[model samples]
Target: MSLVNQQIQLVSRPMGEPTHDNFKLVEVPVPELQDGQVLVKHLWLSLDPYMRGRMNDGKSYAQPQPLDEVMIGGTAGEVVASKHPDYAPGDPVVGMGGWQLYSVVDGGQRGMMRKVDTTHVPLSHYLGAVGMPGVTAWVGLNHIIAPKAGETMVISAATGAVGSAFGALAKARGCRAVGIAGGPEKCAYAVNELGFDACIDYKAHPDLKSLSKALKDACPDGVDGYFENVGGMIMDAVMLRMNAFGRIAVCGMIAGYNGQPLPMANPALILVSRLKVQGFIVSEHMELWPAALKELGTLVGTGKLRPRESIAEGLAAAPEAFFGLLKGRNFGKQLVKLA
Candidate 1:
């Protein structure tokens, strides 16, 4: 059966903050599924900060989206029709499907579209806690930072998907986890709900030096591991308190993603403290996904790991959700429900 699909395309690249004019929503006919291909009806479309980088026409860890292309994203969907034997109709899977109502993907491209059992948790969790963001937190923390018992770890963007997972995992590993968020509500959620030992409000504490002092006060033991998310002043603040032989896992720089000029880096601190600061993309640690999923799923199933999702209904709201994510308006995982 032929299907009508609506997709949001990048109309223009933004200089700093992206406005609605940068996106154009268009309706088109869904392409026919080819051999070793499947037609998926997207259920949940994730709006992550990393998407901000893709909107620009620049070289980065991933390829930039060409002008007028459907915006790239991770999507959870059900297979409506399958030309491939590995996937059949009604199979729920997750993969790099664009922001559209329907998508057709070949078997090779659909390798990331692993079939999921929705009975275990809500299908949305697969896009959040059990998905890329969750895996990012797990792999980066476990493999890179490797926080030990009694160590102190600090995570920026602490209420969002990856940051939330980092805080929870750090606490589970017997380390003191401190979260840094934009507002009081998110800070409360990070501390009370996510079980972070303390949460700092960057908005409230605008001065990086003061924020560093506050963070150091909360983490009297010194910051052993830093999960760097928003990498502007917050990063500089956290760097001030890095303990000797500290490890920094640079997951993202949401603070600089909106075409901002790169800030001056202070290599002196790294040199003085002998800090091991490394940047990584989730794709680099795909081999460890099985282990991450098992641990994250078990934590969620046992009520230890809690995911808070800010879900926007309909594909039309996706652009707004994307804007909200960049502005720190999202409470947790920002998602658009397309199905």
Candidate 2:
């Protein structure tokens, strides 16, 4: 084994869009494991929109990523060395190992490092569809949307990890799923491949008026529930189309994550439509993870949920890949293949 461990660190905070200078890749000596600790060699690293919030020093659901420390993220890997009795060498596990080639984790905490069964679902799925993103979709849908048959549900960032999984889950539950993606290709994939009833290309209709018209056209019955991912003009358009008593699960506001604060322009719509808007963090609801993951895993295992991924080749590509994700350049879940 190599003596050095390569990792990415946050060198600076981004003012708006993150630049290459914000990250620094460095190599460090691998630390020796202590009692009840295990060493893992990461195979995959997940780059998510939520990580952007962690970069800033402002208050958030999670703490900011300390400078010069490894960037925070989810990773899937095999235990290469073990001092913990429960974890043997070659055991497959997934956890929040951050942006590194190897991770040293305590077995007791392990970042919830449960063993994975790759015989059915691939190890990578444990990082995407069957992982946090997938469970997030489940939580929002089951707990928030609670859709009935024939209900029209719309989601923004429809080609992303959370949106794609949410769309599939809604479809399986007999609801009509409409998606809003950045490009035509992504929109097409959402409808044709992921089984979304319809998808609107936000890029094609740049203005709020045009996007609202497109959404109205796509969901003629009016939006019964909304899975919000980007809270900008897209959200304003959705707000205009929401039916009375509509429920919205405010999962993310990536449009304003960098520095812009795009507050809702249509607060009156919430009152006029009598909508119920709730924002939640998936990690806060660990009690529902077992049931949610079981359902998400079953869907993924049987091919019912077709989760797509846009994978970068190595850890060096992680920062660039994440930048692309912020600009809606990626087609699906953004991931880094470290191994």
Model 1 agreement with the true structure over 1-339: per-residue lDDT tens digits: 578999999989987899899999999998877898888899999999888888787788888888888998999999999999889999998888889988887866635588887776778888898889999999889999998899998999999999888887998999999999988999999988899999999998888778888887888988999999888889988988998899999989988887676574576999899999999998877789999988888878777889899999999999888988898999999999997
- Model 1: CA > 4 A from native: 108-110, 262-265
lDDT of each: 0.89, 0.92
lDDT of 1 at 283: 86
lDDT of 1 at 53: 89
Task: Compute the lDDT of residue 197 as modeled in candidate 2.
Answer: 91
TM match of model 2 to true structure? 0.97
Candidate 2 stretches with Cα past 4 Å from truth are none
Q: How badly does each model clash, as a count of residue pairs?
A: 0, 0
Highest-scoring model, lDDT: 2
**For residues 1-339, could you state the per-residue lDDT of candidate 2 as single tens digits?**
656899999999999889999999999999999999989999999999998999999989888999999999999999999999999999999999999999889999834588888989999989999999999999999899899999999999998889889988998889999999988899889988899999999899989899899998999999999999999899999999999999999999999988997977879998999999999999999999899889888988898888899999999999999999998888788899998
As a whole number from 0 to 100, the lDDT of residue 33 in candidate 2 is 91
